[model samples]
Target: MSDPVAGSTGTAASGGAPLLGAADLKVTFAGRRGSPEARAVDGVHLDIAPGEIVALVGESGCGKTTLARALLGLEKPTTGQVSFDGAPLAYDSRALKAYRNRVQLVLQDPSGSLNPRHTVYEAVAEGLRIHGYTGDERAKVAEALSRAGLRPPERFFLRYPHELSGGQRQRVVIAGALVLDPELIVADEPVASLDASVRGEILALLLSLREELGLSALVVTHDLGLAWNIADRVAVMYLGRVVETGTVEEVLTSPQHPYTQALLSVLPEAQGEPVVLTGEPPDPTRIPPGCRFHARCQVLASGEAERTGVAQSCRTKELPVLSAAGTAQVACHWAAAKAGASG
Candidate 1:
């Protein structure tokens, strides 16, 4: 019913401050003069401390990509604000250019992100050239390639996109981001296109990079298993809002939000009866008035109200913001009651 608020702090390795954050961000794209505007991201608050690897997970069209873009300064928020190092985001040419050097984006498809006509050297060096790097550009490109696990960098320097395997092309994209020596990386489905075997390698590369360079990453993905594999913290998005977020173990093993429960029930390793959501997620332009998930939530349909107000609140009251439910923060009216029953 009310705007979603995150109650969990999550596990951030850095104690002093977050390296990047989004404070109550909302991004809306206006439709035709008569049509309703599409609210892609609605009232999201997120924090990424230095060197933390956080996963933003959801089904397609859940606005994870839009939120990531807002954090990277790629898209302007319709309201609220984005911050870097405790300061509001800067938009001036000089300030924005400096910001770009600190944060880089790795798109879902490397073939689409990389230039088909450019050599590996040119692809990686583009950032340096644009950023006005006066040093030896060749050395920087070679080192970045090497860091991305493409050893003997010169071997692939002249290779075209068609020449390299799917895995290698993705590696080139990562190398391009690394060439900038960024402090944060916003990787959107970094391994979705690669083979299953290559997925592990790319994830490993991300971990190794964090260990070696102390880089913070915001990984956007739909695969819950991927979040289990590499993320220190996981934020589960439904429609335009975050429903649950916590350490990977807490959220995965004991999800509190109904949407999250439904999602995990379909996981390959999930046991017992799976929750098959009956209806399509509500359209962004016509989001339901109360709890967005109420129309399809099994919990609301079958749950016996432990108190007088729970059921009435589920359908009529605005959904509650994230509140502490054991180890996770959940935006649901009966998360505590459900946890108690399960326990």
Candidate 2:
């Protein structure tokens, strides 16, 4: 229950420097036929310290996945920089290969991640082979399997992906990542495809990995409950940017941004009616001027913006990007105004 990022320098809560960090990162896809470019990730700054778990929470198209891909060096950023251990990430083939050896990715669907044709041992050994791991591959793979909570590692070695259950398949995928002895893992919806009963098991496995291996993670998810259960800190994304961020107890229990409040309001444990905003998220190519979330923000519609005398600013004034290093922060004109008034 301690503040995981109490004295964070935007790099880490543990104060040992960030294992991974992104600064003013942006990823854009050019459109054909003279169409406007789609900015999937726009100006995001994030950090994952050693032994820290930061959940990037948002709806689809909010750019959390794009940001993750950029951090993994999978997607080339249009601007900004990604740093690991205070060194800027390099895009050269050799450098990327070296970077990937230390930073691994766990995709959302375990079924898709594993090869149907390969046995569990082969599947997990693929990474070791790719990285030219010369040391005892068998023993390393077995250890990884055991660490991922697969009992009697050899029992599942010869089995194919189709032969394993969903949870087992996921553990196999995780074992694949662990085999590399990575310092950080970018897990994209790690448990989204599993059955309700299996989700907890996988989550517990991740937590155990963090504790046992001193691993760091950037968990890209939409589930606030999942964030609450696993993440030490939470960053709420909206419209290709982080709208709010803080410790789990701070952001989830006392959300500052309207988008975050609405997200938590709809959770099963919430007492009040959900704050349903009108219309869908704006198109990425044609992001509106000023506050990108203004069109769908409930605070503006609920008269709170007007009450605080910042309705015009909400519709016309762009808020600065949230700082990545802070213990708690929000990007909202109304929230800032409200706080100023209260002060």
Candidate 3:
């Protein structure tokens, strides 16, 4: 697919580190009902520096998985691009083949992802086989298993997907990705299907792998609290665009976008009254004109909403800008003031 959105055109280009970057990405699919095309992932821009973990969070159908598909070159985009190591990639056979080794992905469901018939050894060694493993396949299998914390290696080498528990199956999946020794990894809700007790173990394994390999990752999840704790940076998506992003401390502590603030405030221990968002998310088919969050925002100020007829006319009709200074970039009317105070 072509690069989706514009890349580092403004600030990301001025000075940004990019191991993997997605620029101005738009992913639209034909409507199931033969209606207008559904623009699932629209105009997203982000960069993942070498060894940094960035999480993409949003409501389920707001384009998180679709964006991941584009990033991994699994799905083509309507317009825009995703690049690796500071270079844009075309979907040629060579480029696609090279991507297989340079970047790998951990899927959400281990059971569905792994072949029930293939032994763990076969699954992990498949990457080696495809890439032309000329040496000891057994040695490669042992190394991958060890790295994924599958002790002794031999115990898991003969196990099949159904024979292992949920966490073990996930470990096998991780082992498969590791065999490629990828520079970047796109983990799509690695823990979502596991039992709650197994979630932490899987997350820890991921963190360990990151530290061991110095690998950059884009972790996708709907849980903001998970992103807050695991990600080095967080990008909040709503409708189809990235509304705010920053270092974990900056975004989590002082979120600028109402949507971002609302996301953060919903966490268990977060103070203040529970901010209930009214109305379902706007349909992706006919997104609102500007500031997609305006439909459900509490930050527009009640009186302002009444006087400006914003409730009826949307006071936030003007498209806001996304700004970054130091480690924070937020798309909000108030971010400029924060930038001013910092200056």
Residue-by-residue lDDT tens digits, candidate 1, 11-87: 34334577888878899999888799888888888888778788999988788999998998889999988999889
lDDT of each: 0.83, 0.88, 0.78
Model 2 RMSD in Å is 2.3
Worst 10 residues of 3 by lDDT: 1-10
What does candidate 1 score on TM? 0.92
Please give, for residues 5-34, the per-residue lDDT of candidate 2 as tens digits. Answer: 332223445557788889999999999999
Instruction: Give me the candidate number with maximum TM-score.
Output: 2
In angstroms, the error of model 2 at 64 is: 0.8
TM-score for each of the candidates: 0.92, 0.96, 0.87
1 against 3, candidate with superior TM-score: 1
lDDT ranking from best candidate downward: 2, 1, 3
Give residue 12's lDDT in candidate 2 (0 to 100). Answer: 40
**Residue pairs in steric clash, candidate 1?**
1-318, 1-319
Candidate 1 lDDT (Cα, 0 to 1): 0.83
Model 3 lDDT per residue over 71-110, tens place: 8999988998888887897798888878878889899999
